[model samples]
Structure formats: structure tokens, C-alpha cells
Target: MKESTGQTIMIQGEQTGILDADTVLITGNVSVPAGGTLTFLPGTTILTTGFFGINVEGTLLAEGTINSKLVFSVADTSGFYNLYDSRGGWNGINFLSTDQAGDSSIFSHCTFYYGKAFGDSINKMGGALNIRNFSKIRISDCEFKHNKAIFWGGAVFAEESDLKITNTEFSDNFCGTPGPPYGYGGAACFRYSDADLTGCRFYGNSSTGIGGAVSCEYSDVLITTGVFQDNFSGLGGALGYLRSNPDRPVSCNLFTGNSSLFFGGAISCNRANPSFINNTITENHSVSYGGGFYCNDSAAPVLINTILYGNYAPEGQQVYIWDVNSSPSFYYCNVQGDSAAFGGTGGIGFNSPYLYNTDTLPLFSGIYPSPFTLSDNSPCINAGNPDTTGLMLPETDLAGNIRIVGNVIDQGCYENQSGLTATGRVNKELQILCYPNPFRENVTFILPGEYHGNCSINITDMSGKMVFSSSSMKGNSFNWNVVTDKTTGLNPGFYCVSISAGKVNGSALILHVE
Candidate 1:
């Protein structure tokens, strides 16, 4: 070890202990022995000169702050694109099966870039963070970018380990080679492991194989409130869930703008029965089938209060099943097409036994720039299951709003705080006009001055249960404060109101109250 005047150290062999300086260079293989710990201070930088790796058979604690992040990278990868092996430089931390003290290991507010994995079959995995055996690890608030692996995970690979990652960002990572099952998971892969990811974002990652961003096989994973966008692959454009399903369902996520060369523009489920709830899948493209999702080999994903729209494919615009063994079920969802529009083998059909789903425009604020907030006239508001008992939804949606704002959860990822019910734009054909259509406490009904005091006003809930019934007192304009007036037993929801005042036009109006 050679220490410079500025406290920068150069390590040519194994290393351990605390690295509190601003710069540390690894010129050769480095290993932290078992029962040992390698700690990095805030703003510490670890730079690898060759294809060397920082082998961690013990524990690594890199706890940096938001203002001071620990960085692991190569010094220069200037002309790396011309050479396949040099594109992604340096070997990342190899948490081998021999590791024992890694269970309590934590890495937070760190940045990993330009990591690569390629050699024998055993070494060609996990470009950035590789783990094996029964060890458990926690990685939070980390950024991984421009990493590559010949097989398995481009940024991270884990087998038989419990990996908990939260609030991380993965971008521009890729699988170096595209092939069969081996070349998968452009960003991350897990096999026979148990993992939990929360509030993660994956975009601009790709593989010529299965998952463009993430792939899992024989692993149980619970991912909540994730965002996957603009990734592409041959099969699953964003995620490939293969033979993996955790106890808790993957909920309140957003999958958008992903494309596939073949099937499942957003997600592909193969022999995996993952439960998805309150997710928004939209604007994905597939050349053949299942623009939003593709399921095969006994895969049956249960969807609740999910929204799928604007997906493009030649056959199944939203979803496609390879055969009858796979049947995706939707409950209280907002789908753009009906059952007849779903496609599969031999004229097979999709199964969605629940009711109260709208098959029209959800009226989003916009398609891109995230959030995709709901407009006032959107039918998705208050469109979820009335009872939020066993739903197991996240407390917050993608936009950080309360998941269930009104009587029920919103249909998509965003909860509209403004409107709680679906009431289309008021009709001009009706002579009777109401101000503050989605009123909080009260609303005013204005007649055309031709109705009498006996004008009938009836209000019923969506289930056709009469909630309020009254006649016009004596004026052309009647203001009713439903909250204060005990005579009006009004509840918050969509109400169908019919007014018959002589011949003032016979029409039913849809009104909403919050």
C-alpha cells in the first residue's frame, strides 16, 4: 500500500479495515477475509485500475449521505465501445458463498458504474453486486448505471440469498450477450432467492433475451411501487417473472413505454402466478402479441384495480395467453377493450369475473413526464373495490398521494384527490343545470323558471339504492347542503339524479359528491 500526501492510498493486494480517505485505487485482486469488515467513509471513492474485483467474503459497509456518495468506478473507459470485454470495466464486489458476516452488511447512497463480468461460466454473472449462498444484505438509495454482464444480472445477480433493495435507480445497464435463458436481466436477475424491492426505478436497460430490466427464475420477489419504462427485449420488455411469486403481491407499480421485439411489451409471466394489484400498464408496444402482458405455461396473474391502455400489438392489444393453462384475471380494473378483444391460442379467452370496471377512456392528464395524474372527468376515480380490506396496497401511490383517497382506491397508479367519483362532462341537452357538479358540502340545482314547487328530485347511488328524495320547495333555484341537512342522507360516490319538472327535459344526470 502506497499512501500519497493527499491521503489517497494505492492498494496492490488484499485490503480491509476503514477507508476514510477521498480516493483509494485497487491495482490488483483485493479480498476482505472472513470475519473482517471493509468500511468506507462518506465521500470515499474506490477506483479499480484493471479487471480486478473487491472480493467481499465478510462484510462491506458503505454508508454515505445524500450530499456525499461513495463511488466505485473505473478511471477511464474512453474507447471501450470497440472492444466487447472492455465496454464495462472492472469487476464489482464478489460476495461469495463463503461469506458469513454479510447478513448485517449495508450499502446506501452509493454509485456503481462501468462494472462488467465475463470469464468462465461461474464468473460471468453480476456485473456490480454478486451474491451467493444464504446470506442476507440490504442496499438502499444506490445508483447503478452502465453496467454489463455476459449472463445473469447486468447490475446485480443473487442466488439463494435474501436481497432487500429500496429506493434505488438502475439505468443504461445491459446484458452483454443475448442468447437463451442465460443472457437475461439487463439490470438484475435472481435465482432461487428471496428478494424485496421498494420504490425503485428502472429505465433504458435492455437485453436481447428475456427481461429488458429485471428477470427472476425460481425466486420469490415482492416489488412495490416500482417504475419501469423505455426498456426493450425479445420477450419481456421490462420484467420477466418466471416461476417466481412471493407471498405478498407486487402492487402499485407503473410499467409504461416499454417495447418488445416479440411478446409481452411490458411483462412476461412464464410458469409464474404473480399477483399484481393497482398497477398502471400503458403505452407499451409488441410486434406480435400481448402488448401489455404475455403469460404462458400455467401463468395466471391476478390483477385488481389495474389500468391497461394504449398498448399496441398485432394480435392481443393488452394481454395474450399462449394457451388455456394461462388465464390472467382482472377485478375492478379499467381496460380499454372488452373480453372479445383479448387474444390467445385457439380462440381462448381472458377471465375477469369481477364487475364494476369501466371500458372507456380513463382521462389521464398526460401520457409522459410521469405521475400520469387523472383528470377531473376520468372514470378511474373511485373505481376500485369498495372494500379495501384484504387488498394489501401500498400507503402511497406512484405520485406519493394517499393510495385510497375516496371511498375506494383509484384505478391506476395515481389517486385523484380532487374527484372521488366518475361523472362525465355535464350534458347541455338537459335544461336543468347544476353548479359545482362535484360538490363537497352542497350544490345548487337551477331550473328554467318553468317548474313548480312539486318538481320531483331523486338521487340514487350506483347500486340503484335511493339515498335522497325531495321536491322543489318553491323556487327556480334550490340549494341543498347535503352534509348539514339531515333530510338528505347523502353519501360520497356517484349518484344518478333524475328531475321531472313538468316538461323541462327528461334526462338523467350523473353527479358526484366528495
Candidate 2:
């Protein structure tokens, strides 16, 4: 099954059905044989020649949805030019093989611009594309502009691979190639592989010497719902995690950002213990060390509910959790600017770690006499950590509802919940008023009256079985003895009567039968 010379071969180089060539004009160096299924409809346009354009190995179903798209630019047939003049022109899709493992290949809703990378190094121009080693790729909602991987992954160069990127976009990828010892990730470069990024977005990339956007060694990433902006890495504008062995545990996968970088800008866990959650790291910019984050030495990162605003490395400010053995811990967090560090590099607390609820976590609403302005009752408003029930929350923010009740789940990535209202916050309204509302079995639980005394009456049966539980039900009233028939008989449905009284806990609405 090897016959794909170029210039057009839909069913000719087929493996199944309809792929009648929407535009397959690969002018040089081509080879896509191995049970291929390369489909590219929806306003299609494919043209490659700078060096190595589309070389899949087999099974490449170029998917396109979200409003017609599957363009791989670079052939204007003169027509007066100017698609940005066709930029560098080649190197944006290469899934080679020496038997590089298996897994359905797909490049969804495609869009890669001015591609060029494959030699002078940067892994090849910004390393436009070269994912060897046991491939299993799936790049989603793609978009990479001004491609340049002179070496690295200005676009992508994953080795020993198994990648899955979503909602993609890696901006201004640069790095003119320089590895060996010079620096790291000008845009993206990983070794000893295992990547899994989600909801991706890395902006304004730049890496003169070190990871301007990303560079992971002994790799292991699992980033989620992303946004790494204004990237610049002399060290780690957005990422730079390295690890040889300290018990060997270098693993990344989570980082939160809303307004993105200016320095170690959004992340720099140079030792690795990655698992940062809920991000909205703001206003980044560096001067000396880390402007937004810079966890060094024994990198320990497990920060949950993140939000650090107005970041700046003003003469060495913000973060610099150095000295290894790093035990970075912060729950339901939110830290404001100005982390002192003059002749005495000490900002955001150097050593002596272990801190909890930092002043209940930035809960200020007023404190600006001169230029200290912090108007709208600051305390970062509504403060976060609604206790985070079972964790894993983020269904919709960035303006998409369903995040949490009252829309109050702020700490980053936006979720103001608009006109949020909970009024008389406490008083849970008699803990949620319910006087046997619709009860049957000799029901009685009227504890509102400002609720008092000993109480603990549970009667769950919505599958949460616990048919009944009583604890000396004293005060307001409590009585339920409809044992229905010894051990099983009542067949009426709906049942949940949780009553706590003392620290207030209420729930009622029952129905029983026999």
C-alpha cells in the first residue's frame, strides 16, 4: 500500500472511502503509507514544501468541525502572495515510523501558520513536527502561528511519545535552535516522554537561552484547562522542570493561568512534584528571578485553588521558594503583590515553610489610603474554598456558568457569577426550613426556633441507605417508628430526613408506605 506521489490522490492512496483530495499538493519529500485514511474536507487546503510537511505513517483522519476547517497553508500559486507572504513555508506535520507504536492519529480543526523547522536545530525550526518512539497522538482544535522550531517544539517534537493535546494554540513559537547546554524550551521540548495537556494556550513565546515557554526533561506532564500567556524563558517564563534523580519523581500536569506570564511567569518547578490546580495567575513579568512563581531545589508543588495577582519581578520580587527539599503547600489560596527582596533575597517567605489559610486567604475588602488602593471591599471578594466538596470542580468559568452555587468560586480563571446573591448568608433559613413538609410515617421534626439542644436524626433511603438513625432526639421534636413491617416492606420512595440542630444541619421531605 505505497503510492502517494503528491499533487492529489484521494482514493488513490486510500484505505476506505471518500477522501477525494480537497487539496493535497506536497511538493517535496513525501511518504504516507500504512493503511492510510487521510481525509481533509471542510474548506480544505493542503500545501507543503519548505522541507517536510505532512508525513503521517498511517491512519490520519484529519478531523474538522467547529465551523469548517482543515487548512495546512503554504501554496499561493503566486496569486499576488501575502498570506503573511507564506512565512517560512514548511515543517508542521510529521508522524514518522520505525514502528513507532500505535493509536489513531488525528489533527482536529487544524490551523498551523508560516511553518519551518527541521535542521539548523531548535530541534528543527521550532521543531515543527517529529513525534517518533511509540506514537499515539491526538492534537485538538489546533492553531500554532509563526512556527520556528529551529530546534525543540516551536510547534511539536515529542519523542518516546504518547500525547493528547486539547483546545490547542501555541503562539509565536521561537527559539532558532540551541540545545547541548545553551538553554531549554524556546516554545516546547520534552525528553523521556509522557505528555497530556488539556484546554491548551501558550502565548507570545520567546526563549533566547532557556525555556521561554516550556522544557521538561525526564518528562511527565498532565496540564489541564490551559492558558500560559506572554511567555519568555531565559529560565522559565512558563515552564522549566528538570530532574535526573532524587528518588526520580519528575512529573507535571497541572497549572492555572488567566492573565499569564512576564517572568518564571506562570511556573518553574525545577525539581518536580507537579499537580497545581485551579489557576488564574495574573499580570506576569520578570526582572531577575521568578515574577509569578519559581519553585526551585527540591521542588514540591501541590497548590490547590490558585490565584496570585499583579505579578512583577521588580528588582527580584514575587516568588523564589528556593533551597530545594521544597514543600510548597497552599490550600484555597490567593496572594497579592510586593514580596520583598533587596540585598537580602527574601520574598513571599523563603524557608521555614508550612503555612495554612494565609490570613483566611486574601480576604480583604478595604485598605488604600495613598496609592494602596484596594476599593471594592477587596479581601479578593467571597474568598474561595467553598470547602470544595468532592474536589474536581471547573465545569464552567471563563464565563460559562455551573461552576458552583451563587457563582462564587473565585481564585482564578474567572467566575464572578455576576450578580451573585445569597443575602442573609448564614441563618441557613432555619437551616433550610422544613417542618415535616410532606411527611407520612408519624413524622415530626420542627427545630427551627433558632434550633437548639442535642440532635442527630438521619433517615436516608434514596439509596444512601441508613433507613433510620436517632440520637436521643430531645428538644423541638423527633419521632419515627414506622418500622414498616420489621425488616422490609414499605415501598413508597422519596426519603431523606437529616437533622442536626446544634451546629445546624437540616433536610426534610419524606414519604413512606407498607
Candidate 3:
């Protein structure tokens, strides 16, 4: 491997044909020239032999289709592309420095797999990249599997950059230090940056300290229609946020399912105040407190039309809002769980949750596999705020479906309908759903198609009471607020959500409150 100090290299510009080499290696550090394009033809496989691989400084636009997918992996003297052999070798590719002006670098339809690491810092670098300070960067249709980083970010470590990520799958990435002061993240880590992630799936990863799936620190992230399941971390199981700043802590975008350790088993926000609306946070367990959420000394999270079910810890469980100064508010929010009530604690296991509305009990009656179904006559059906804005809801869910329908707002990320199934399921069909049932606190619903037009969604409670609602819907989702009391009002009962168009027919639902 020859070393090059310069930062400009042109690969196949006026030249075409396949540049097939035994090892397409980068010696020292190489960068593409300004406004230059490096194109990789079909059936192009590049191999490197350094601590780091090809580092792109300028713009990189590598587009590969299904049949002729681009591959970035290790090389042996025997010319074998071993998938499971990580005998302390090398990183696949590295993109260090990017162009300042016109910072729109994109990587699409690529597969980064089977990278490894050893100790401290970052051992085997990026499976595909490690970028910094770039704008409008897009990575889509990519698969990062069986990649390992010693410290953080299994597939990619994007820092101090504004990026848009979509349709990416990160699986089987491990980042766990067994000894003292352990730290690791199975997936990506965002620090001091702004990013929007959509249609991404994070599953089957393990970490030691925090954030097995994703970690956000001192940054603003918006996640829409993403799935986080079966990921494990010591502190925050699926997602973790550790922001030092009191006023402007790191905030992650809305949508659902972030299981954690002490607080927010599905999603945990330590000192952050990210908007959380219309998400399903369930089935998360904590060893001590906050089966679903554990907040302390932080700003009160704004929850609208979201569902919290089957989340459990020990003793005092569910949402534990302790030491948080700001009073948190929940409008048409549903919290359903079971309590064994040890040590004469009683039936309720939820600790003190800062309330805007005082209905803190689970509204419906039933058990898992079918708890808050509309057919079961659950109170969560239509209990929502009628005054939520379009800015609160997402443009679409993970499968690119719209979020709002008629004037009705469904609960959680996926709209509950009579017959709808979750993504990545074998029998993609639902048995029961919830809609326009009578809401009191908040209303949640799913959209029909991709929401591309402007719309508004609202909510109200029983006895013709209007509590929360909103307009300015920019996308397909909606979370209507109906909580009237900021501190301690709202008797446990039922609620409703009403949706509308530009002078068109509306819809409604009834929700059960406990």
C-alpha cells in the first residue's frame, strides 16, 4: 500500500470500463477534489489494507441496485471474501473530510458488513464511513450488519454534521465493555449535530453503558416511523440521551419503542425535552424504576396521544417523574400496566408522573396480545386532545404511510385500525384497531397514504368538552391534546378525538380513562 498526502484523486471520470484490482487500497489519506464525482460501476468491488480504508474528502455518489450490489469488505492473500472471519483485520471504508461548500454528499443502495475492532478509541473504523461537518448528507437503502466499533457507532459515526438518513437497517452490531467504566453503542451515535432519520430499523445489538440502538448527545434529532426492538443496553436499552446543558439538552425526534434500563425502557430522556407525540412505547422493563419512562431533574416531556402499555419495573413502576422541576403534561395519553403491589404498595405501581391531566391510571381492562383494542371496548380508543398541531405529528410512519385521517388522530406511531399489521411481520395484517372512540386527554390515529398535503387535527372529551387540538399539519401524522388541568384536575373516564379537512367531512372516536 502506497501512502499519499494529497487530498484529491479522480477515479474513472472520462475513463469507463471496470477498474478491477486485487486490492483497491488507500495508503495514507486521500480526498476527492472539489466538485468532483467518484463513480463506481456495477460489479465493482474495492478492497483496502490499512487501519482505515478509502477516505472521501469531497462528494461521493455511489448508487447500486439490487442485482449488482456494491460490496465493501476485507481481503485475504488467498482471495476469499469471508463473512464471519474477523480475526483482527481492518475497516471496510472511511470518509473523513468532506467539502465545505455544496455539502450534499450522498451514499445510497450499499451494503456494509463484517467489520471488526479490538480496544480503546475506534479500532476498525466505519463499515462504510465516518463523516464530519457536512450538510444535506443522505444515506439510504443501506444494510449495515455484523459491524463492530470498539467505542461507539457500529456502522457509522456521524459527528457535527447535518444529515438525513432513510431506509437503513442496522443489525447484529455489538459494543459492550465488560469491565469498569464500560461504554458502547451498537448502532449510530449523533453528537453536536442535527439529523432527521426515517424508515430505519435497529434490531439485535448489545452495549454496556448506554444506547444499544442509538445515542444522542447535545444534538437535535428527529426520528419518524422507525422500529427499535430486541436491542439491549446497560443503561438505556434502545435509545439514550445524555445532555449536559440544562436549557438546550440533546433532543431526539418523536415516534416509538425505546426500551432502556432505569428510565424510558423504550426511550429515555435524561435532561432533554424532545417532542414526543403519537408513539407506542410498550413492553419495556426496568430492574428498579420507570418501566416505561424515568425522568429526574429535567424538563417535563410533552406527550400527546401516545400509548404506554405493558411497561414494568419493580415496586414503584411505569413513569416516575421525580426531581423534575418543570411540570410535564399528558393529553389523551394512555398508560396501561399491571401491578403486583409488593410490601403493601397497593395495586398501582406507577410513581409520581408530573401531570397536566390527573387521569394517570390505565383506562382499559384486559391483558396483553389484546389490551387496548377497540373491539375490547378499551377507554384508550378516543380519549385524546383535540388541539394538536401538524408540526407535532410525523409526515409518515416507517413504511412511508401518512399519519392523519379525517379529523381523527390514532394512538402511537402505527395507526390502529380494524385490520392492520406491524411492519416486518410474516402475516402482515391486523386483527383489531382503535379509532374515533370518544377522547378526553389525547387522540392518536394513523393516516391512509403518504401525507403530502396540508391539513389540521383536533380533539375533545365527553359531555361535548373540548380540551386540546391543533392545526398547521404539514404531514401525515396527528396528536391532539385534550388535557385541561396543568397540575391536578381530570377525573378518570372517557374522551374523544375529531379530525377535519378544508371544509370536508370529519371523524371521531371514544377513549376510556382510568
Report backbone clashes per prediction: 0, 35, 71
- Evaluate residue 130 in candidate 1 and report its C-alpha lDDT on the 0 to 100 scale: 82
How high is the lDDT of residue 371 in model 1?
32
lDDT of 3: 0.53
Across residues 1-514, which tens digit of lDDT does each residue of candidate 1 receive? Answer: 2221246887856667887678988888888777788888878788988888888777778888888888999877664443256443888888875465444778999999988876777677888888888456899999999888888788998898878999999998888464454468889988987888899999899887888999888888878889998898888999998986656777888898798988899999998888788888887878788889888888877878888876767788788878887777778888766656677871255554636666765556543355357766566788888887877788898888788776767888888888446654422223556676546677777877655556777766545566677775466766767766663546544455556665443333334434
State, as a TM-score between 0 and 1, how close model 2 is to the true structure.
0.35
How do all models score by TM-score? Answer: 0.79, 0.35, 0.64
Q: TM-score for candidate 1, please give it.
A: 0.79
Best by lDDT: 1
Predicted structure 2: lDDT: 0.55
**Which residue pairs in model 1 clash with each other?**
none
- Global lDDT of each model? 0.76, 0.55, 0.53
Residue-level lDDT for 443 in candidate 3: 49
Give stretches of model 1 more than 4 Å off.
Answer: 1-6, 82-88, 101-103, 351-354, 367-371, 423-514
Evaluation by lDDT, superior candidate among 1 and 2: 1
Which tens-of-lDDT digit does each residue in 293-352 have in candidate 2? Answer: 776667776655566544555444346665535656666656543233311233344453
Query: Over 4 Å off in model 2, which ranges?
Result: 1-23, 29-67, 71-90, 93-116, 121-123, 129-141, 144-153, 156-254, 257-292, 295-318, 321-333, 336-344, 348-397, 400-411, 421-514
